[model samples]
Each structure stands twice: as C-alpha cells, then as structure tokens.
Target: MLRGTAAVSVQRLAPEDLGPAAADCVFEALAARPKPVIGVATGSSPSPLYQALAASPRDFGSATWFALDEYVGLPQGHPESYAEVLRREIIEPLGLDPRTVHLPNPHTGDHQAACARYEQQIAEAGGIDLQILGIGRNGHLAFNEPGGALDSCTRLETLTEDTRSANQRFFDSPEDVPTHCLTQGLGTILAARHLLLIAQGAGKAEALRAALKGPVSRDCPASVLQLHSRVTVLADAEAASLL
Candidate 1:
C-alpha cells in the first residue's frame, strides 16, 4: 500500500506459510549486516517465525536481540514474562548466547531512567537492523496503547482493560496479568531500518485493516506504520479479510 512517500508492502498467505516467509525477511536482514541487531516481539503471532529460525541452519550466534516490551511486576523468571518467554522460544531454540539478548527492565526502581538506558543501549548497538512486530487486537504496536504520542520514546505504560483481557489466556486469571509494561515507544520502533509485522486469525482482521489502510493517527497506534519508509505486513487469509 502506497500512501504518498511511505510504502507498506502487504502480503497475504496461509497460516502455515507465514513462518518461512518471515524467516526470509530475517535472513535478508542478517545478510545485510555482519552483526545484525534485531528487535524481536514476544507474542503468539511471532512464535512460528521463531520456530522456523530455530529449525534453520543459519548461525544466529552473532546477532544481537532486543525485546520490544516486558510486563511490569512479573517475577524475573516468571514463565509468562517476555524475557523468559524469549529465552525459551528464541534463545534456547536458536542457541543464542544469553549475553547478546536484551530486554527492558521492568524491575527498576526508576522506570524513566531504565527507559533512557534502554534507548542508549540501542543507539550504542547501532540501532536495530530489523524489527519484528505483531499487532494487538486493539491496533497497539508493542505495549504502546491508544492515545500515546506518535513521537513517544521508550517508557512505562499502563495496560488497558482490552489488552489485559486479550492476554488473560496466558495467565491464571485476568487479574494475574500485569497492569503496566515497559515498551519501546513508537519513535524507537520507527528508527529501525526495516519492519516486519505478522498477523493471523480472524480476531486480528479489523486491527490489521486499520493498521494498513486506516488514517495515520494515535487512536490506532499501528496506523503509524503508514509513515515509515520501509514496512512489510504479512497476514493470514482471515487476518487480511478486512484489508
């Protein structure tokens, strides 16, 4: 989809085919840099892609990874914490060194300072070469909820009821889900050289449409992708139905 100077490439494929397709994008990013710094998202949508990467013969040992967000108040080793989730799903499977993986510090006493330090780390790593993302049903990118500033930087954000409800399946109950998170802001995400967003299932149809076709606005946080120079959106048949 072309909107003036910004272009978003949209591809629709079967649910099973998304992994390989997304892997191709990852490999391309890896090939472009000697030591690619990838921004990885934690969620069900990106699970297949991680599986594909893990199964491949590619050597991801040299690549550095930064997580997009982490649930505040979750214990360090909590099973559902984004950090541990990434360790189990990506680091372990891909045989990546734990030293090369980075995630926002939700346990910090001063969250504002933690957010700044994270941004500095990314900058020192030469910025992210490729950023993998998954849209929330509410159109949020990462934990950047609606009403957030488009130029917002990495910071703490309170999760909305809708976001909490959507994530309840991962917890024992809705109340167990964290009320806050530390997320890479829209500005930080936009700084990435390339973006690959994957979506699946009918539940994501409307948000995917709004992200790829709706007007660029804070109301639909993902709609901000329309302003980026390079963005690739891969969705399954059901998710692309509204598009």
Candidate 2:
C-alpha cells in the first residue's frame, strides 16, 4: 500500500510486469460479476493491460464499458479520438459489443445536457463495478486536468499544454490536436465501486508519488484518488521508486 495516504493498495513491479498484475485484478472482478459495468481509460500507459484483457479467456459480451473522456471538435472518424482508440485497442480485440459502450458525446451541441445524460446512463447501469485509470505525467486522470473543481461532473474543458504535448504524437502535429475535451470529472469517477489506477515507467514516478503521498488537492487532480474508499494503485518498480 502507498504510505502516508488512506488504504490505497499499491503493487510495484517492472514495466513489463504491470500488464499481468492489472489483468489478473480485472479478471477477478469480471468473474465475480455477471455483467460488469466497467470504466475504461485510453492513452499509451494502459495499452499493456488492454492487450492482456483481449488475450484473456473471459467473455465480455455482456459487459458494459464506459470511456473516461474524448476530445472535442475532432472529426467523426479521427483516429486519435478516444472512441476510435477504444475500438482498435479494446472493443475489437476483446469482442465487446459496440452498442454497450458509452462515451461523453463531444459532438453534442448541448454539452451540458450530454454530460447529464451520460451520468444518468451510468447510474442506470448500476454504476461502474471497476474503473481503470491512467495517471498523466502531470498527475491528471484520464483528461481531468489540474486546478479544476474536484466535484465537477462531465463537461467541456480546455486542455493544458502538458496534456496537449503528451497527446500530440497521436495527431499529425502538436497544433493538430484539439485544444478542448469532454471528460468525466473527479466526482463522477469517485462513484465507481472500485478504482484501478495504473502508472508505469520512471518518467511517472514523481506524479505517482504526489498522488499517493501529497495532500488531497486539485493541483494534482489524481491526488483525489486517495479520497476513494476502494482504490488500487498499480505501478511499475520505477514508477514506485519515489514512494
């Protein structure tokens, strides 16, 4: 467990070792539930876990999935969009039904209404059984950037320079990435029954340390995970070095 915080269990392993660690936890969750309502996060950090789940023998045909966030103002079929990324990496490989997957609607004209609707949908599904998260180098979860309201719900938010730069590789150029996104807020994520926060590599060590040891504050959005009752911090040895 991470020291100096609440009961957040931490698993320190090598970068290559994180995949099986996370996959095993996810498998346990799915086996215990009939139709798991799961929240899935995107980005390179969780790729290994996604691949492991795809190769796992579990049948997720009845599972319902929710994406953490999506870029606003991107084209319908943009490859970098969270929707496409989830399809290529998770949905297709895992054989999950596309209709059962949900994401905050970036294309909706009434962004506020869309967020509310998405929240309602989650509630209707009996809330998320397990939420998978990836902490940013800046300590942001999903696209929940720093200095925002901790209780804020899903809504449009401007992207920080750090987040944009980190995500630019998926786009043609740095400027090509969208400047805004629609993300589930800290409050929304906290509603999950269980949270699996994954961080790997030495580059993420500082952020992991802050999130686990620092005070609960919006400065490091991920620090809010400490407030949750059921959170598992899965990190690589290098990422846990600072702790």
Candidate 3:
C-alpha cells in the first residue's frame, strides 16, 4: 500500500527491536563513510534510539548532527528547547563535539536570515547523509504541520493546536507551550541522501498508514517521502498495524 516513485526500504519491526536496529544502521553508515553527517529529530519517540546511540560513543566520533527543528522565540536554555534535549540525549552521551552539531537559533531577531544561513550551512556540510524523523499525530514532519507545502524550507511556522497539545507534555501547562516554531520544510528534509523515520505506540498507527499509503499531499505532510530516493521506515507492531 506504500506506493512510491522511488525505491524506499520499509523495515517493519516491533518497537522493542528498533533501538538496536537503529544503532546497527548508524554503525553501518559510519563504517561505510567515516565522519558522516546526521540529521536528528527530537521527541519521546526517538529517545530509545538515542539511548542506544549514546551507549556507543566511539562509533559516533565521525558523526556530525543537525536538529530537525526548534521552537521559535524560546531561549536556548529553555527546558523544552530542542537544543537542550539534543545535548542531553545525542551530544553529551555520544561525546559529540559541540562545534560539529548545528542547530538553528530559535531566538534570532532576523529569523528569515537565520533560515537562509542555516540552509547554506547545511549545503556546506556536504548535505545530510541521513535524516531522522518522527510523525506528528496529524502526520506532520518536524514542525511542518498539516498543509505544509511539499517544497518547503527552513522557516517560521504557526504551530497547530493539535501539535501544541501533543507537545504540551514538555511544558508545565498547555498555556506555556509556544505557538510558533522554526522547522525544516519537507524539501529540506527530503534533501538528505537517506531518511529514517521511527514510530511507535498504537496512537501512531493511523499517521503511519497515511504516511506509507495515503496520497502525497500537503494535508499529510510526511507523505512527501514518496518522492525521496531512499527512505527506511522503522515502526513497532502497533504503529505498523495498518501496513
């Protein structure tokens, strides 16, 4: 049911199997090309994989990482900031040099310029070797909420109520959640040579199905994977039920 114009490798597995498998994939990529540049997503969904990756730090020495998105207007040290999350999960544990990891400045006054500069930095890093993703309840990617254009870029976005609610757990109260964010567009995400998306839990089943089988549309942003040359989707049984 997951139709694609390009050959996408679909690896369906139990959620319990994903963390180790993801580590193996990282190892393989690193073995093939040392100093590989990696694109990372933050959220509870990717925690397991990050834990596994952190367990093997030396294997990650050659890796450079880029975060998928950040909440606009939030300070860098904010507890809910993606930068803080990445530091705890991917940076410190993996012993990755801070200089090698690039993240957009969410608090920049000139957000548009920040985005353009970020894009240029990505290109200068030889492009992303692998991009990691997690699906929103509404099938969004990064912060690209439903209805995001297929060829989007790094820019500001108004967070949907659904997305804000889904992310509220990170804040003390729903009211504390930011209403805006800066996310990499579908086009930016698709530019990676390889894509790996991880989904788990029963709640993700519908979105996973939509991503793999539904029509590629701005309404279901993640569906844009249909156009990517290499995409590997790893999901738990509950998440893959529809597939």
Candidate 4:
C-alpha cells in the first residue's frame, strides 16, 4: 500500500544481504531512466551497496552522479575529500565520466558563491532523479545535522560534536575533522524523485526508529524523510531492532 503520495518500503535483511538489495534498487532506477541524475551518499553503510553495483552487470555510462557533502577545509585531493572519495568509490570503479560528476566545492575561494552555483547546476540538470542516503548516528541525512531546519537547502552548516566524533575515524583525530561542511539540506534531498536510505548495525537502531516511525521533526534531521513521497529504507535486522 502507498503511504501518502509515495510508497515507503522497508526491506529487512541480514547485514551481508543488504548490498545486493540496495544495488538492485539503484540498478532499477538507472535502467528505467535516461540520463538519470544519481545522488550518491558515502559511508560504511553504503559501501557494500557500491561494491554490489561494481560487481553487477548494470552500466553507468549514461548516468550523471553527485556527492552529498564535503568537509569545509579539506584540500582538493585529500583522501577524505568527497570529490576524491566519489572518484575512487563510484566513478572510476563503474567507468563513469568524471566530467559528468558534481560535488560541493568546499575548497573554493568563495564557499558561499560555490554553493549557489552548485544549487543552480543541480536545478539546471532537472534536479536529482534518485538519491541514495545513509543515516547518521544522530539521524542526520548527509550533513543535515540534528536540529537543522527541515526546509534547508544546499549550504554550509556547522558540524555537531556527535557528527564530528562519528566522522573522526576518517581523520587523524577529532580536532582534525572539519568544524563545518557543505551539504544538501532536507529540502534539497527531498527534491529527488526517489530516495533510498540504507542502514546497518545496532549503532543506527535508534535513528532508524526515529526516521521510520517517529513524528516528523527537525530535531531528527532524517525524520524529515517521513514527509517525502517516495522513500525506500534498506536496513539490517540490527538497525531495524528499535523499530
């Protein structure tokens, strides 16, 4: 049955079983659309999904790709740079054209102007057709941290302590993590025609519960997903435990 204007489906599977399932969802979207604009999220939860896609038969030659966010102070070629990560994990592996890819430019001289241009570029491309997301331990979608405005757009946002701590693994230490980031906001994310979120492990259980079942609120940035019409949540049993 449909929930509101969109049908939300939750597929519960083992942690190892989630990659192929989510990859299948992505493949279906890509195969069904011409020049599909795909929004890619980076994280451990979606790493398996990317692996599955890399191993699949689907072709990514015709699709355009975009990354969800980037740290404010990272250098252009830093290992943790979103641009580099997308290139390594999604574009190169799939043989997709890097020229057709887009990511927020945190390294630019004028960050604010760069954000405006990024938003315009996405709009000019007809918005995103499908967006893959991973829930932060704090229920954040991309870098839309908790307590963020629900209708926010792609812009620079300060990172919360929890968010910084969670991402500290990618840096040398907590202090090495950027204090700010540029991310597509809840409104920007909801603009995508299809939204797919993947979650795994018990660490994501509480946020999964809030996003899937709790009332819509800005307190849980991901909970704003409940307002979108088309959303699919792929979760492992442990992540779905609280729900």
Give the top-scoring candidate (TM-score).
Answer: 1
Residue 50 CA error for candidate 3 (Å)? 0.8
TM per candidate comes to: 0.97, 0.96, 0.95, 0.95
Mark the 10 consecutive residues where model 3 has the least summed lDDT. Answer: 1-10
> Candidate 2: which stretches are off by over 4 Å?
1-4
Question: For model 3, what is the alpha-carbon lDDT of residue 58?
Answer: 55
Model 3: lDDT of residue 233: 81
Supply the global lDDT for candidate 2. Answer: 0.87
Tens-digit per-residue lDDT, 30-121, candidate 4 = 87778788899997889999999899877788888878888898777989888888888988888888999999888778888888888898
Using lDDT, give the best candidate's number.
1
- Tens digits of lDDT, candidate 3, 12-55: 77667888887777676677675788899999788888888877
Better of 3 and 4 by lDDT: 4
Model 2 weakest lDDT span, ten residues long: 1-10
- Candidate 1: what lDDT? 0.92
- What is candidate 1's TM-score against the reference? 0.97
Off by over 4 Å in 3: 1-6
